[model samples]
Target: MGRKYLTLASALLLALCLNACGSRPGTVPPPSGGGEGEGSPLLTPASPDDCYWTAVRHESYNPSFDRTEVSTMPTEKWWADLYLNEDGTALFREVLGFGYASYLINVEWWLGADNVLRLTGEDYDGELVTMDGRMEKDRSVMLETPYGDRFYFEPAQKPDSGGALCIADLEGTWRMTGGEPGAGEKHMASLLNIERRWSDGEEGGYILRAEYYSARLLDTDTPQYETQKELLVEKREEALSDGFSGEPWSARLFSEESGAEYLAALTERNTLHLRRSDAPDGPQTVYTRSDSFLPETLTLTLADEPDDALIFYWRDPPAEVAQPLEALPMTALEKGGQNRILLVGRWYETDIQFCTGSAEQNADGTLGEWITDTVLYEGTLGIDEPQWFSLSIPEKNARLCLFMKRPWDESWFTWPITDQDPFLVSGNTFLTET
Candidate 1:
């Protein structure tokens, strides 16, 4: 009986070993070339002294939804290629499509360890391409600038979404309203309402888009306009979510009577005009200059007196702060009359590198930690608007940090600039106990 039990235990041990030896289905064994599995080539660790070269190409395509024929490059595949590529001394580029394929485009290039070259242009098929073998570097790659130099080919984490630079150019508030003129009336109220949406590229330029909302009246006390108003409201809400089916601009424009190209041209800023479809002698009207609705710019301010208070600034101030309130260092203020508190340093969230996986392994790839959703007005004040934050000061002595928030991002993060003293106020100055 003892021998029989021993035999059973041995058999179980053998079975277990065999199961361990068997390969699981769908699991690819590490590749022979030395990379562990088919992991992204871009993430392969670099040699100690060697600088790597690679890039994430963000190709923007503003394609319409219904048009099934239109195609776009997947973001994950492009990102994978950047990490999986075997060679580092090469230019990496990617192109992607967004929206209804009507609005924006972006192109990014990496020049080795520290140099990065970017170019942007509009039009779906605009003439834009950059390729030259001479630009390649077989040895070390570096870019020299007046202030300092950077290793162009090195890898630094970037944000998840793709966005345009010079978003700051889109600065300013645009009171946008939509509608066409009646037969006798020169202008009509906009059917769509506008909401502000700020997009920060990486961590720098901030751009705001006033999302237009179209509303039709529901049942109301006004009998004559009730039915039509309800339908209009339904249509406007549809426009907000689904947008214009084939061509968003048509539904977005003044009237269906307008030409397609004409409406397309209006997409450019301050160039819209009311013109007839045919005869040259037809009466015409133009909407330009101040007549055009534009975006508004929020104001920014910093601290007063002793400069040690300013350490960092972040875009998208934290929600914890009550806007227009100052962040003061409590203990520092009580001692030596040194109210070492910082305020009013305008900061914008550019990017975040979220480290994930087991902290023990440290091998798990860094997920995209950067955000491009909203521009934050960060400092040490609890001001709702950045402009208001700058204009107000704290009544007491306390050290606080402020930040803005956006809809697209998950949690708040700070930029390197914000981590450093960007707004430190001290000395006998105007910003004193008052």
Candidate 2:
């Protein structure tokens, strides 16, 4: 096999792999989960029935030296699955992307006279690779390569596969079941845990939220801070026909963090494939029914105030500015007109409780609610990188709060009822940030 082809296949396929755990480098561990006993099995002829042979042992010897070496050391590759059909067709699925993707290469195979198994396939770079295996009593196939390389084969316990799947079939929790997403540049927020409920919050739509960044950030340059993403996945009305499988269901996933939607597809084999809607050909992640869940860490960074929070008064407060707004007691909230959202330490029109929970952890570990001077109701999110402390003003109403948008400007005019939350000057009232 060409080194370049192998490198490309390995990078793109396993890049999205999950649970990327390993023992040591340059050491090939025994294949797990599918095959039976391991290491140099007793010789037997290959079975006539169609089956997949999981590569158990990969060994090679160089003939250049005076003494040739066989299997000097098997390389540790996450996936090298070989599928043989009774009809003489084969598939060599190489998975290298740490479980991110799989590249299926077409192969042709035939059992010649005396049970000689011949096979041919191409790598990612279209480099041709040929190997011949001898079936001992038709029980096992031992493949031999040019460098005296050998691959011990055993039947893979293929999972039961069904035809088309409905939304109900995939409503349960899903887990990532590939090799861990190793610390590579491409390891961006791999799926850790997923729960797909077939309800639209009010019992009509769909909601799929999952834990992300399941793969630990071994690489120092891992981008982003939040480890989990709250996704709003809804099933699409249209159905898609997949030639590789059968009729499959389609869905769309929305993320508040990225403010971008993703497309999800499902078919047989209990697998859910997710890819970005904009970059269809870009990186994708796969998930299967949850078995043993992988553990994930959460890192929360609470800003001093909401990203849209601002303090602008008709008259600028003293330069030292102690307490821009008075701390209105819970009872004082009744003084506001129409009783809109209330702010504990901030100003509000009707004094409504916009949200609950501690703005920041108290010194005694108690909880206290507080916010900034005022919040700008940004029309839509994902406009500017939102800060947890910065107030969110919808993009449409952004112009209303134009003075506040200037982060560098030290002084600005206060829009009062026109720009603040529960806009008193608005044609339509806005909902409180949950």
The candidate that achieves the highest lDDT relative to the unseen native structure: 2
Q: List RMSD in Å for every model shown.
A: 26.2, 21.3
lDDT (tens digit, per residue) of candidate 2 on 103-167: 22456665433445666776434668776775454345677654465767766654344321334
Displacement of the residue 75 alpha carbon in candidate 2, Å: 12
List runs of model 1 lying over 4 Å from the truth.
Answer: 1-134, 137-180, 184-434
lDDT on C-alpha atoms for all candidate structures: 0.25, 0.40
lDDT tens readout by residue for model 1, 1-434 = 98676655544443332223221212322112232212211222233333223332222234575332322323422221121112212223222111121222332323211112222233224445432111122222232222221213334343222111111112222222333433544322221121223234452222222222211221221111100111110011111112222212221222323222112113334323222224233433333322122111212223322443222333334333312122111122112331222233223322222111211111353222233333333233322222222212233321233322332546654221112222223221122111
lDDT of 1: 0.25
List the candidates' TM-scores in order. 0.20, 0.29
lDDT of 2: 0.40
lDDT of 2 at 174: 54
